[model samples]
Target: MRIRATVAAVSAALALSAFAVPAAHAAGSTLDVTFSSMKVNSGKAITVGATSTVKVKATYTLTHPSGVSVANVLSGPVLYRGTSAKDADTQVVSDAPGTCTTVSSTTLHCSATITLPASDLYNADAGTWKQGGVAVDAKSGVQKWQNDLGTIPVRRAAKLTADATPEPVKKGGTITVTGKLTRANWETGKYAGYATQPVKLQFRKKGSSTFTTVKTIKSSSTGALKTTVTASADGDFRYSFAGTSTTSAVSSAADFVDVQ
Candidate 1:
């Protein structure tokens, strides 16, 4: 495991923006902090209107000037509304603080959870968001020893719904499968069909544990799913969307077919 001690290379694999490092007016910097074991929802996908979201957790070690024990740490996902700091909006993404716990003289940990309603993220421009930590002096509150936790990609939510028709069919007969692919539209506050996208048809025998790809199909102009397969055995069929850079992936529920 590579231990990251890059004091200069502020950006880690998770990709945080240039440190806004709140200015510290103290003498020779108030404190020095190092953060590690940073975990952000296991780097999971975040969606709008999602509740009870525990976005980030991290451990820290601190060094203070002339024996001033550290105070609190403020950390969480910080969002810059646009592509740059000049954007009109900037702030932490959660309502909760990056609550911290001290385990030793130089070791501590922190975490934050948020339930952002649609207004918090759905309307924001698509771009990179950051997670980070900051140290404050116990006596004075000058922020310092800040470290960037990482980043979590923000993408539009997508959904896949499917159905296989002619449920009980002759063993050698044809069964039609249909489905649709849709994605969140922030402006309209609705989910709309995504057209001309590649989706895969997958199947698993009712008793088998594996699902094999049957074929790749494309959605129609209206994001409609229409495909036919020759029935051979009782099994479950589903559709999966591989997803694009601007959207999240999704898979439809299994639709079982009874072969007579």
Candidate 2:
């Protein structure tokens, strides 16, 4: 899988530049700004799928000294996978600077978006990520970075499939259900099996809107699912995965079965 050129360039700049800003800045000038109330994706997990781009919204409060001119500053949110941006295993940044609304002479409420394309990420990138903010003085090139404002989960999107064999079966006969569980593999830009995860078998009567859990089973090493249920009535069957820290929950399309 190919990592986005933009991300690679930005990541390299983050490691080499001062305060994690893309641009080079003066050595000793202090931006003298503080970031607070940083909320990434509204404090929710970021779920990304294969071949799609995920845009995450972030909001924060920026405070600056009255002597500082906020008009010439460019600031935005940052997501990193290590202790700090300079040493991060991977990092993601907004394409544009954050837009801010002045709340007071010394405070501004800012919002920005960070885009994540599956091709730019690796499977190992899924997990807890630290949140941070960066401010750069457009005039003097002074920069400041605030790390560990909070943390958020970055998870891979999961998929489940369910199929019931024997469209029409005797009421007392056996019905076999099978499925596969898979999640986005950013390393390969494809969906791969998610093994050893618990998934639920659910059923709903033909006319019902709610599905009740029938049984629970663990996916095989290959993420394949197979089970047998005694046929009793006409209904729909599906597999449901509750999800985990690194994966998003998903349910398969309902497969209708007819009982004689």
Candidate 3:
């Protein structure tokens, strides 16, 4: 009787183990992840060097069985871009795991403060950048979910500076205005001049807020600006750059000049 009981116990345990393995692997229903929204610069272009951290938001919904819980959610810059060393997958932008707040049984509010290093931004091309998110299930290792947060243009940051010679000048005198145009150069690790680009010379009366564009001047080979203008009234002078496909527009601080 003892030998018979031991054999029966072993057989029952083996049967339970066989049934459990199949049930765990054959989880039913497809897992779905829907991101209702994402915000990056109000759905506009992203200007690198404008900020160190990229703040993004997304609302997500996971649809699976009632007992399944989300394992991980991630958001970062990615490419459905061309095959190139620089364009290869999202190696430049590191994985940013989102810390989500639960809203309901199947819904989650997620966000990630992603950091795009200056070096990466400096090397990456200025074009359409995609924000993607992914979700995983904890219980059933078989579930997979992915959604596109959105896409936005990423551009380089440019700089402009202006100065007027002989700040105190007699009325009706010819004053020379000098300035420089520069932007980030990843290869050189320096702020290099951006030449042959059109920039506007603008002026505003000391008491007035409105600025009138006096003339358009192009930068020289060294990105230097040297233009002479007749000083009439006490006013402020500056330069404005209309950015290119790879760079963002920028304007210099107003340089105040005193006219006697």
Global lDDT scores for all candidate models:
0.60, 0.83, 0.59
lDDT of 2 at 145: 68
Q: Candidate order by lDDT, highest to lowest?
A: 2, 1, 3
lDDT of 1 by residue, 5-62 (tens): 2222222212232223333544465446655555555676555422222233333333
Clashes of each: 0, 0, 0
TM-score quality measure for candidate 1: 0.72
Residue-by-residue lDDT tens digits, candidate 2, 1-260: 13323235353433223233444454656688999999999999999997778988899999988866788887878788777753465777665678899989999999988888888888888899998877777667777767898999999999999999899999999999999999999878789899999999999998899999999999999899999999999999999999998999999999999999
TM-score of 2: 0.89
After TM-score superposition, what is the CA distance of residue 31 in candidate 3 from its true location, in Å?
4.4
| Worst 10 contiguous positions by lDDT, candidate 3 | 1-10
Q: TM-score each candidate.
A: 0.72, 0.89, 0.72
Give the distance in Å from residue 27's predicted Cα in candidate 1 to where it truly belongs.
12
Off by over 4 Å in 3: 1-31, 41-44, 50-68, 71-95, 122-124, 138-148
After TM-score superposition, what is the CA distance of residue 29 in candidate 2 from its true location, in Å? Answer: 3.4
